[model samples]
Target: MPSPAPSSPLLTAFHDSYHELVRFVARRTGPQSARDLVHDAWIRLAERQRSEGRRPEAPSDERSTPSPQNIAPRAYLYTVADHIAIDHLRRGQRTAQRFDSSGKEDGPAFAASPDVADTHTYRQALAEVENALQQLPARCRDIFLADRIDGASHAELALRHGVSVKTVEREVMRAMDGVEAALHRWRGETAAPRTGRRRALSSLLGLAGLGVSSSALWLGWRQWVPQYQLQLATAKRRLLRQPLPDGSTLTLDADSRAELRYYAARRQVQLLAGSAFFAVARDTERPFTVEASDVQVTVLGTRFEVALEGDAVLVAVDTGRVRVRDGSGGVQTLLAGQMLRLPAGQSAQPQAITAVAPWRDGWLDFQNTPLAEVVERLARYSPHPLRVEADAATLPVLGRVHTTAVSGWLQLLARTLPVSVQPEEAEGGISTLVIRRRS
Candidate 1:
């Protein structure tokens, strides 16, 4: 066989760890100086390789061996950043000493006078960058602090949290890009005008991009929102309201979890567990879709709700129209004030939407819904695992239960229905509820 082609190990290493390495540097230095530090690190690495005579002699016939693939690039990149940050701090200390000995204030060179206009501009730019980072998701923020501040490895985090390494990598990428974009916008907006005295102003603006415009900032926000997935999870008896990337909003019910994804051609959400109400924004060019248990709902713009109960999917439309498709390729169109239940291996059964997604108003309305469904819905908000006997599970139930009052609703079931509620305590102070028909 012919000799295998030589790959650029340096390029591969940079590609694998560029985002995370820059984040590591940014935590030590400010975001504004992170780009320069990373660039300097790369230059020094190349110089070291050249001095050591490790440079490849030819593209096809390499003389020097590349860095071993088994060694993670993150460690190597982090080492380079550590040296850069130390040098930066040392230079700053030395400059401070010079100012002290010369009887001069240690302030920015651009702000020579105390009342200079540039001072206010610089402060405002920095404040905006900080505020933007604060608005990022909590998980993203935590990952950045752990990786950059504590110097934790991605594999270490994965093992500690019982998640895959890819999860940590994604979170780091999201936060780094988000902070970088915010700083870029800040620099672009606060760039000074080029004049006789400020001829170097153009060089400052070039760090962000070529041009500075509101459209550019908006486009940056749109593009960055899709790089990493956004997750919304709620604990028992707790509900959450989240804003979507497409200017829409969603309300997740108790014990629910969902993931949002916005692509060029479509805006999609996966209802991983429980129920959620979607107030989708109008986008005819890109239809909004919800993927749930064995069913998918597609709409251009609408107010709708999807509930994943067991193996079935329940869809309700409050406003606009919804198109639901089952796993068997059966399609059903539902309009405002309409609802449907799609059971596993069964066709969609349409019903009149009597209350326009009562859950949106903090109520779970059931009209002749099975007792088993009532128990199942209440279980999401209940602190204990709920179990219903077969006879009681088959009985019909009709009531509007409060989302946050699951215990009260179950108690009412024992009073009105021919069933008894029994609470069992297990080890570790854990409790469970069992409902069965009265003997």
Candidate 2:
């Protein structure tokens, strides 16, 4: 044979490297595309080598050049082929920049699970709860909400209202109790005709049985029946010791609302909005679960507070261990006093790790908390909009706050800091707070 042309090194090398390059691509791109990608890469390299009119780069060892008897042409061709294939692939990848065509976008998506946490969703939910408040008694609702949503303490509430501490406590408790009962009625529960109340009504009906006015029963449903909507959107409270068939003992905060779904074996409470401190009674037989936004806080014998704030779920373990499961199959175990602030998006890691919760003694503890946050927390109790300018809210503030008189604290806040608090008339109701930079 014509002692193969002296410049045969390139061809030999290409043949040698080809297979290795294909295998490498196969691993990186998976088996399906590996063959095509690698072969394409090899073809492009061959064209480039041909265009340049250069022998494929080859090992510079001539002394050991294989004799014709041991040319091993197949292996040699593959050797050069591998390098050329990989280089071609790299170049093609850079030029093409293949788009991720997996339909699902790269960023966040709305989800019922903890996977998609949207701040807007949480804010909107809170807003919905606010709208539902319209259905509740105004004064009673305000007082009840002032306690939880506002972070008001009994003494502070008493002092602010100029009422004796005892009366303040009584009124707060009464409001909470009434809201609880109101919610029960709303859920369409019938107050069984008590033997006495029934007899009295029966006697009245017997005397005027023929003339029993239709308006009488209409008035009766309004007066005697509880219209608590089971799936109510408003903020409310719940306090109980015994397992309500579903086996959950919840110490619901003031102005917090929840949807109770009692099943044969499972008692599910969807905390649509607001905060609740739950001490789930042990029922080895049934599971006590509370769904707050995207987080499912489940426990059989644990005490924890799950608050739906903005678009985040704030799970704070008060006593015992509680497991908070997020939308993305992420489960976090919270110990006492540990507050986990889980934001939107499926984050295996917590978005914000906070210090000891202050609401243990029914008071909010603050540590290097922002002034704006303080104002926000304070707004819950008062009939005023409290806001923190972006600059001010971000400024680190360290202090302890009572739930009562969050608005009053702002007065003191102005006295202590250079920040100013102003009201926005355009925003209706006291809930809307628009903090602006002071001129």
Candidate 3:
């Protein structure tokens, strides 16, 4: 029988950290190219060693090796692997810039060339993304990495975690938002390129003299129009204020998201999820409309808040009138100091309110609102989900609840209402507060 050839010292080092290196690269370049990058790393390591005149030192007896430390430092291997992965990315970017044999530039290429990739700005963005992932909660990080890096579907994650598909979706959304928020914070001072905006505006103005107005230009732009999405993650505990193209301001609550689209006929805002307060600009010619959950609210100019609560849409007007039309052909008008709740399969009914959109002022006023409903609202600002069980869920809650300290309010519920709050005992460290009736 012939004895198999022993692997080289470099190969041994790579084999030891193979899985870890693949995961690390996967986090950056995604899973599809992770293995290729890993192979590139090994080749780069050998080339680097050869250039430095530091060839792999082979031991006489491989079996006599003391430990992994004696073979090669894992840190050195990982460092070399990272450098190789980065260089691979840079090369890819450079390739993207050059025209192929067809004499056409790869217009869809977003990869940075070696020169651009070597810049500190490029490295900083990469670091920011990694740091953002690190900052996510354990469960959230697991779900995100599993779904993104491991290519697990939402159903798989839900089944693995024993939760619903909606929960998995929310976790993924949270992970993405966390990364975006971290990058935004790190690059807050960085100014956006004004050339594109200037060009867009110039194009619009150039057409205005041709009897076509800015709105008409926007209508045409809608064909290839770009849309911007804003996401507020759980890690971002502050409200986000965004200025729309038409000068309107949008204030989003924590853990909220929305998409903005501008056109000549209308300025549309889609509440993809979560709560938002819109201070719409007056444009009678192009009415502002907010579409959320099966309902659409239109207004020329108004200050109002729209919250997607379960299967219902809560529309509260602070200043101007809001016309809400449901999917079932039901329409109603809400004036200032009035609110309406349009539940699924129900018409919009106006209700009187002393103050509209109180949450904007850091106060949540609910007159005889169910404890379950209040808990649900508070869950948005809370880091964890809130669960009210037994009779406690039906208790009517009145007065105002402050948004700053939801924990204190929950304790108050225990004191005032016949309920007790406690953390649930679960296999995974799921952050959930359970409120049950006091025995």
lDDT, candidate 1, at 51: 46
lDDT of 3 by residue, 1-439 (tens): 0011123455455656677878987787666566545644554444444444554332223223233335455665665556655654564555555423455564554532234422344345445656777678878877866654444656678788998766775687577566545555565644243221111221223221222222222233333232223444323346777887678999887667887776546778889766899999899898888999889999999999998877788898999898999868788888998988888767866887777666678877878878888888888767667898857877998867778888778877776788888888665878678999987
lDDT string, candidate 2, 1-439, tens digits: 0011235554444334545655765665444444444433333334444555754333233223333224565554444444444543453343333332345455332212112333332333333333445455654455545543343644566566776655654554455344333333443454343221011211222212222221222233233222222454333122222334434555555456777664334556788766667777777665667888778887767777787766677787767777778877788876766667776545454333344334534566666766665555555555655556676667666776666646666666665566666666653444545555455
Better of 1 and 2 by TM-score: 1
Clashing residue pair totals per candidate (backbone < 3 A): 0, 38, 0
Error of 1 at 183 (Å): 28
- Best-performing candidate as measured by TM-score: 1
Residue 110, candidate 1: Cα error in Å is 59
| Local distance difference test, each candidate | 0.66, 0.51, 0.65
What is the C-alpha lDDT profile of model 1 across 286-313, one tens digit per residue? 8888999779999999899998877788
Candidate 3 deviant stretches above 4 angstroms: 1-236, 428-431
lDDT, model 3, position 370: 82
Regions of candidate 2 where Cα sits further than 4 Å from its true position: 1-247, 348-361, 415-418, 424-434
| Segments in model 1 whose C-alpha atoms lie over 4 Å from true places | 1-228
lDDT, model 1, position 102: 46
